[model samples]
Target: MDAKELIRALNARDEAAGPDLLARTKATGPLEIRGELLYAPLVRNWYELTDSLELIPAKAPEWRPLQCGIDERAQAATGYLLALAEADVFSGVVRLSRGEEILFEEVYGWADQDRRRPNLPGTPFNVGSMNKMMTSACVGRLMEQGDVRLDDKVIRHLPGFRPDITARITVRQLLTHTSGMGDFFGPKFFAGGRHRLETIDDHLDLIRDDELLFEPGARFEYSNSGFVVLGAIIEARSGCSYADYVREHVFEPAGMRSSDFPAFHELDGQAIGYTNFTAHGAVTGPRRPHEDTLPRRGSAPGGGYCSAEDLARFGAALMRDTLIGPDVKAALLGLRSDSGSGRPGGVPYAHGFQVESEHGVLSYGHGGGGPGISAFMDVFPDQGLTLVALSNYDDGARQIRRELRRIFWPAA
Candidate 1:
């Protein structure tokens, strides 16, 4: 059924599923919502569900590159993306790469629909929690410098944390999302004054007194606050702000000139992020710009910007060990936790990266987006391939990423 019919069904069938699903979606940190049809990052991707609106409840949950003569597959992928664009279902960039050479690239929709400013190849899109990988790399750098250790307590690096809460957390737990720390985004984040959270300290100040949701190393959970704490720790130990550290160590060395934590007010050339969910997450609402819901600037946990090319460059750097030393790289990319809570089957996580394995082939990457922002990046090390999909429309990159995955990888 269409959205209208589906809403009718939901109203007759249940009353509170929208808010519950919205809460779970917000907890994903990127705040991804596509009206009644939303998906959580990493934890849940969209599905071809039945017409019954499956609204009651639930929980949440890739491919190859060039060098092959797969014209039909390539054309099919392009057609699917074009259909999404034509139907106003997507607005963003989809880039598939084979090593340094691009295999398929497409730009869709307007960066500013009113001014008719179309999103260009270099247009920076808010990458949401994908920035966690960058934050993870900064931690790795500190580890290599011997300034921090995986076993180090949060209190060791960030003494300002409540000892009882922090003593139970470790650098490794934070990286692997087993820290038992919850996210910083919820009612309080959107309650107001988020614009004042311009620095890591500002965000940390908000979560310093938080209660741990579980014991450290209890299990795998996607904790945006955990990454925020990592950002603060990076600043405290390296004596450099997280942004500067990323720019110097992660972006510059990887040739990612267009990636950085630019302030929301200064988003002149960046894509204007849009969303359908209110801060309260209206399951069905008119579309709106996504900036007013943001902080003054992006933080360690998420809210950074990057172009498709730069994102691909960053992925390549991760695979080449340019972002961290060999040992750290190997450890960070190895599957560290079972991520099959309600997610796609057989998916596991390693530190900050999401691992997808099928038919004895492995792909490492992360998905980031929420509301008016959608992005996905993956590197098939065994195949020498990379995929980057970014969008300013609500869950814009999701469809492109999903369809491409069908072309590149099998269900088995």
Candidate 2:
């Protein structure tokens, strides 16, 4: 349904969902509710069933970029997206690359609302899930060095990997999120008495049951635990911590000076995080020090931060074959899993990146979101366009990406 109607349904069907009217607002700050009303649905056959209404606010998931043909129509569409991002109705940053020329670069929104700090082009922010791509890149470098193989069993590296996983999962499975490992930050850790562990090894205590979401490699299920296990593999095989391996190989090789894995030392120019507090009439302030609010430094499963420009530079370097061998990099971007209904080899999931399918068009990249920020970077190979968007606010980054895709590839 439309944003309003769906909101009304949620409010009426379950008062607990709304709690107090205008519980929290969007990136624009406290919203003014103009008397709620319910009406027709935005799409047919879509219905709301449950409205638990817990304030479990979350950032949006990243959308893949479907390659678009570079023609007159596509160019006009791309221009329109540039204009929309400039309006600042949505906080975002995007970069479009065509060969050696930089076609589009822009930033919008308040980095810090109260201090009036704008999110400049070079501003650094946490690229939550986007870190997974970097994590995969770290693994790729190790593979290039013959330190690990895609077919290697994860347990072979993890000295005392949970018994349930030691004999069942593969490196490729973990990279593709098909290992059936439970989500590392979910209920198993939240509910069990072992949520305080900070390192990847600290998470093993909750892996005792080692339940698979599905048979290994049977289906694609996004699991943070899969990445955590992958991190362990990197540590065990490389004889280096995940952060160090990535810094020495991926980041340094790509010349991404502004990017880094979250470390225990002080970081310069790190964007502060924020969350809304409706208890005192929608007070937006710095995130508290709870497990959910404070970011853990050693989190290899996610939470690497970077600037928009650095990400674009990395994409350009990757396309030029300066980072990894052309053939090996291509295989890393090629389809390695069938995640949906499509041609025999279609639905995409590459080694450490995401493959996009839009009719005959294809693109590869990854997006990341965390408590205080969200980011996405997709490289359109044929079009030579690399689109990067990062936001300081929580959930709005995905919407900006959706609108960008709609502008560039309407059919997608």
Candidate 3:
């Protein structure tokens, strides 16, 4: 069926199932809502009662990469990307690079809309969950130094770690999002003063009494609390703050001079996040300020700020082994879980990176979103292509990356 027909069928099914579909499916298994396949226990019951139709799974299109020269493909892709950015009202900095050569770089819209401060190539934007990659890199360095082990339990490093809930969670599980830990951002996080969550330890309080979402390693569930625990482990083992450890080990070695996890009050050239208000595929109201929507400072799970150039530098550093050893780098890029299917466009999860595979070509990176921020960094290692986009407005970065992928990997 066509896209419109498929969407209509899905919506009709959803409406028939009512709001209790999720709850009803809990007894059987998690709902899998891929194209032409809707497997929910409650829906199955309804389907068994009706003999009029049968559900047949549709085969996914085979993906293959287009054969093309790297430089020629990149140049052609740049024009399409620029057009997509203009059409989408993309407000951010984007940089495309091949090895050490920058193929294209541009900035759009305002950093501070009220102040009329236009976003520059060097302007920093908050990369929400991309900080997890940096955190994992820091852990990898420690592992290389024989300071930590992936199999080590949380209680070994974190003195105050709850034995009941986190006793079985390993460093590897935390890195891979296989840990059963829940997130720190919830009702408690929002209701509590943002100023109180300035440090890793402070963020811990939000999840201190929470129960495991599931048995450790039983399934993959993205947990910000897991990363927070990882940050605390880094601090405890290194005898330094998480920020200081990353700055010295990851940022310095990667040549990310302008990137940092600074407090909200310390923002300088960073963009003021604007919340997009949309209705019926069109912008509706004036964008709202994103200041009060975030924590006072960035955390291990995410919220570090960096320029597009610095993000590209990070990808280059990883490729050159400036931050991690060969073994750790391999593990970081390796597929650990297929967890991010429900949101963020279905990218698979790696140790700390997001793995996107199209046409048998794998790209390793991460994308992040928050109140008024959207950021993405993709590293196509085999192709020597690294694309970084950072935006101050929510939902601004993905389309540009999507267009770039389509242009460069036409067959995909």
Best by TM-score: 1
Q: List the residue pairs that clash in candidate 3.
A: none
Model 2 steric clash pairs: 1-42, 17-53, 129-368, 130-368
Q: How many backbone clashes can be found in candidate 1?
A: 10
lDDT of 2: 0.61
Ranking of models by lDDT: 1, 3, 2
Question: Against the true structure, candidate 3 has what lDDT?
Answer: 0.74
Which parts of model 1 are misplaced by more than 4 Å? 1-53, 56-68, 283-285, 335-346, 410-412
Q: In angstroms, give how far residue 227 of model 2 lies from its true place.
A: 0.9
All candidates' lDDT scores? 0.75, 0.61, 0.74
Tens-digit per-residue lDDT, 1-412, candidate 2: 5455655766887776654423333233223222332211110011223335533323223444446554543465456544444543345566555544656566666666657677787777777788777777777777787888777787777757775566788887888777777676555554553335556676555555667878888877777778878888888888877778878776787777888755423445655444442223234454431224433453566777688777777787777776776655765675434222111123466666777866466777887654455678887766666777777555446545645655455222
lDDT of 1 by residue, 231-346 (tens): 98999887888899889999999998888888877877889887877745554444678877787789788899999999888888877888898787766776434221212234
Q: How well does candidate 2 match the true structure in TM-score terms?
A: 0.73
Query: Scored by Cα lDDT, where does model 1 land?
Result: 0.75
Q: How many residue pairs clash in each candidate?
A: 10, 4, 0
61-178, model 3: which lDDT tens digit per residue?
A: 3434447765666666555545545544467887888766877776788888889999998898999999999998998888888888888888888756787766788888898888
Error of 2 at 275 (Å): 3.5
Which runs of model 3 end up more than 4 angstroms from their true locations?
1-88, 277-283, 335-346, 410-412
Candidate 3: residue 79 lDDT (0-100): 59
